[model samples]
Target: MQGYDRLAAVMAADKGLSIFRSFKRLNAKNLLYLQAEIVNCESELDEIIEEDKNSGDFFREKYSTSVRCLKEGLGDETPKQWVKIRQLRELLDKYNTAALQYAQILRLKPPHAKDREVFQRWLKENAFCSTTAEFNQWFGENDENGGDLVALFGRYENVDALTRWVFRIAIPCFYKLVGYRKAKGDVETGMVYFDDDKIIRATRVTSTITSSAIPATSMIVLYLVNHMAWRLAIIVVYNIGFSMLLGLLAKARRVEVFAASTAFAAVQVAFITNFPRD
Candidate 1:
């Protein structure tokens, strides 16, 4: 009886030790996964910043060159002059499209409705030509050389001003958004790290309780088996029932751990998806 008691104690101790070691390992792995995610977010932010800088530089250079070409084409009155004007108009359209894209990437707010309405009214009053038909009508209304050229130059200046306005408002707001996003990422990372620590501590407590309880339970079972010979069969049945219950509990714990990991991954996905990357 004494030998059997020692064997039961050894088995219970071994099971408890194994559970503790496995949980500790799982905690470490979870921490590593969280750290990796944090690093990925940081790298993505750096890439976005670099791409924005390159885009801004490209547009600025192209805008300057386009302005220079328009100025040089001002004096000519040939068919080639009209073709150059058409090409410049197309280029300005492209610039506007690019500027809108830049603004979207920076998450800039649009102008107020009243301001847009006023700007549209001003364009109509000034007979600002956007289409080829409007341009031809305006050109026919003015003298071919002096007034027409001056009107074209004025339109170009207005377009340039609009581009500058978008950049001026969006660029500052972009920097602020970047700062806000970085701070938010930091806070989230800290929260995840803190939660991981708490989980590990809780796991440690569970393991300690499990380790202490297993041996005490085994000893109690051993005493019952020795003192009550007739109830030994009943004790065996109870032991099997308890063992099955422990197995189910361990399985549930594993499922819970997996659920937690999935939840963390979902949080990361939500953050990345919600952020404007344009």
Candidate 2:
């Protein structure tokens, strides 16, 4: 009876081991399928972009909000098309993230079943949490209270926010384009930001839908200067007749002034051509 009981215990252990091994194999197969699916989706997206390159009418029509058109296909199908593509890519990204984290957790090889269970639970909870704050909180860590990754990348709060928006709005695109993980540590130098801390905080909620070669603050200043310059030019042109009445040589003065204006215009053109707007 004692011998039979010992044998039964050994058989149970063997069954558990077999089950674990089978799960590992299944996971590997799923990961491979997901990666292949991502590649296929990427190729299809490229084809779509190429087809719409001429007038970019596809992009324009897709965004149009006209009431009559909205009732038809454009409102529903156009947005829906992008949404479906995004979901596929997002799933692939989550798979990759999970695999990487799981490999790390496995390497530690916890000595007890309880330890292993804890590690598994941690991975399950943290794997899909989008932001570092959520991940830290899930682990029972006070992310906001501590000197967290958010503070370290304080320079890039705006950029990070935009990245999140891009991911949410363009799911397929978010997955295809490599994204910066909102972890609580150093992000790579490739992540962009503004010099002004105030700008970063202020525009943290702003979208990066439009690309700008210059910093947002600098771009704003340039726009204001140009607007004021146009107004100043208008004022100067309006006062030209008043200047002509100041002297009998007003006609000759006007000719001289016109020649000077043409020369200045040529100089301005040369400057603009040499230094293109970012």
Candidate 3:
């Protein structure tokens, strides 16, 4: 049996899906249909108002009470249609968040939408666990695992480019080399995490390449090119590559990338200033 499957079995007993204690997965199409149903019911309510003004009195009283709750809730307004719309909006927000995170996992723009982009996998992975229902949690929430890809893999943390390359290019190349004779379902390139310990290992190897190789090459190039302007040009080119690497592999956020790139540039500037090409 697969190690992941065994690990999953060992995790504490399953409590099943979260519904009574929490919300469930809801589709945008269904939500839209619900809005249509609301409109239909609203028309019925309107007809009731026209037919029996007396029943309308009860609705008015209820509306008045709801308005008071709205005041407490929003501090406050009668709202565009009804206060229930706000609850619907909140539910929509939750679903939008899950869609985006799933997209993040897919490395696709706007996330692999649970509805259509990757509906089958989404159905298998999501909305059942209380811990995973409201959010994608990226790797997911398990009793022992804590969703970091930490267990079964070590403490090293990264969702990185080298592993992604392995999944995207290397795995396919290997299959080709072996004439596609590998066991069926032996490897999967498309996964939420690609969920590998190899990611951590590859991250270290690539990190070493960046840390050591770039500087060594930069030093050699600076020495070979005597012209100061040409040296500055080389530094700029390398800096751009550095920034891109930080973004692609380091998972560095925009500001972190900017700061690190800036610091890297500053170091280059200081080096060129102090140790002129002789």
Candidate 4:
């Protein structure tokens, strides 16, 4: 499920996120600081220029050679006003860069990618997605209760999106399969309270079960077919399916999928080739 501004949805969600000050705090603070620094530098440089501009001997022909040396010193390309100009330039550069970054960061409505980063960080900090409040916060129609957001998995597109999907599916399925029902008034609110901790633990256990089952599932048919050519064909098919499944379920990158598939195929091929032919 995609997370949203559902800070309004739950009664007990992290209040820090609810009152997040990304715009007011981040952009305004940086902008004001940069602006002040630049202004101060401008004032200071103006004074330096005013003072030093007339004090130099370039106005006197008697000091022409000395002024030329100051102006054209190969040893130091910028001999006059260099420090002030550099400092001003660096400040302006910093301001320019911060402006561009803050444009993305300070929008009234941020881009989805930015939201994803923010919500995902919140999830990491508070473990939001695995909570009963999170589920209820985003479970259904928004209405006055404030849900109505898309589920956070693929849509928000955070880290371990697949793992989040697995958690969502495994939690409900675990309860159903176990057929555990609490007696009425057994818990707070007397409402159905999904045990997120147990669900997460169960999801991990299910993941462990899957780790045992998969990667090998692709090769199970390898031993059933005896002919060398057919076995080779099966191996090729297995590698393709294996790679696809790994990408789909693990959300792995192409390089990761390629590396794992290559490693597995290499080992499987070695064992098959070295074995007795049927």
Candidate 5:
């Protein structure tokens, strides 16, 4: 009775599947018989394998021997050569993928078709993309030195370009006004951090004034406008203090001293006219 009931259930399932819909006639009983045959074959195979304890080990040894033979074919020198070739290929693939990904990610626009092509070629050659900080710094410097103020400002439509111009040009101009060195000194070494001592000193002075006046040119303006008598007084005091500071801290030549004074006076004029403190 149980066998009949099981047979009926299989028949019902086969009917639901529409096994008779096929070109060949296949029924529930035939399928059940095929399943039993599979089980029987599996059981027999397992019993045969169980009889041979070393069968698993034999397969493992066989696999290891095959792998060893294949490895040995490459030879000692070939392995290193192959490894380097593989690594280079992998790096090339990664670099190409990275370039493609970077182009999509950066979405940079070129001025002309030639420029666009050149940009794409450069992207393919260069694997790395500029970080946000690096990109900003690059743009800032480019805007400053690339063109005159009017040309740069008018040519560039983006606010970022204007901001970059201010940072690169305006800030440096104000830095010159301060009695700072063109070059900065290494904290550990008294040597200039950049190029020549003179240039470094000049840059330092300009940067210092720029730093003080940044985001608040009005204060510097007020200081300048308050009194004519006070201007010479402040200038004399600044000169004495800065000269003393330079004498104590620096090993600059007499020519450097003269250049710094000229730079300071020029900076003061520029500050007074272009970037009035008030």
Candidate 6:
């Protein structure tokens, strides 16, 4: 019959549409999973990059102080001073290692000749010296000036300034050189899309609880006031006590949730680390 054929065709079309929608949903979920993995990888890389920057900053601070002392005729001749010098040297080495590792991890290829030349020129002009010879020459000229290269450039008011001008100057340059924008973009996106969802869900739940509580409280108050005026004062006190108890319960729940989330994160880390990688 014609009606039977039409029904059969309609059923087949519905089935096909359902299968197509399911396939699309699965593909979408797969894409989201891949995006999450990429974001996590970038976050880890950003943390490492931040560590490298911190090490570099530490090295610069220690190096500047040590160099200042040396220029001021405060030689590291004593055992204590020598130990400090050795520690500073170790930090410098650590900074260099971190920088190299960062560069390798980021796969930073050699810069263009023009860009390299420009950077070298900036180093010469701003840093007071670009090479070892120039550095030695500058230090030797310290007697001509009242202070050393750092003082000559007026990099800081004094040794106690701790906030190094050179470090501040280098930050923008390093940020560009390290290609931090990509990592920063991924982090921003993840925060907006992933973290925002959690925040929104919490807000909705809190709103629902609050909206429900207000009406319920009002109804209880009204019932007490109308039916039992004598016991109204006691009911009010009871309501206040119940509210305080609820507040404490909410606080405890938050603490428990925080602990559970921390545990889950730890387990995830352990699982990922132990899992075989190809």
For residues 40-122, could you state the per-residue lDDT of candidate 1 as single tens digits? 65566455445534555554234334655434433453223234445555655655565455444334223333233333333
Worst 10 contiguous positions by lDDT, candidate 1: 147-156
TM-score of 6: 0.19
Q: Which one wins by TM-score: 1 or 2?
A: 2
**Candidate 2 residues 251-278, lDDT tens each?**
2355765775555445444443454444
Off by over 4 Å in 2: 1-22, 55-73, 108-278
Which has the greatest TM-score?
4
lDDT of 4 by residue, 1-105 (tens): 234433344313322123232334556788789999999989886775665556664532222236455355445456445466678899899899988877754
Error of 2 at 154 (Å): 39
| Best candidate according to lDDT | 4
lDDT digits (tens) for residues 1-278 of candidate 6? 23324323432432211111112333445555655655565566455445434565454335334655433333444323334445545655655565455444334223323323332343344444446554434223332321211211122222111123222334335556764654343221121011323433554465457546744564444444433433345345544544443443233354654564455335433433444232
Worst 10 residues of 3 by lDDT: 14-23
lDDT of each: 0.39, 0.40, 0.51, 0.54, 0.40, 0.38
Clash count of each predicted structure: 0, 3, 2, 6, 23, 0
Query: How do the residues 127-175 of candidate 3 rate in per-residue lDDT, one tens digit apiece?
Result: 4444454344333344221222212221223556655566556755666
- Candidate 6 residues lying further than 4 Å off, grouped into runs, are 1-87, 91-203, 206-212, 219-230, 233-278
**Candidate 2 TM-score, C-alpha based:** 0.26
Residue 38 shift from truth in candidate 2, angstroms = 0.7
TM-score of each candidate structure, all chains considered together: 0.19, 0.26, 0.43, 0.46, 0.21, 0.19
Q: List pairs with backbone clashes in candidate 2.
A: 86-171, 86-172, 149-184
Sorting all predicted structures by TM-score, with the top scorer first, yields 4, 3, 2, 5, 6, 1
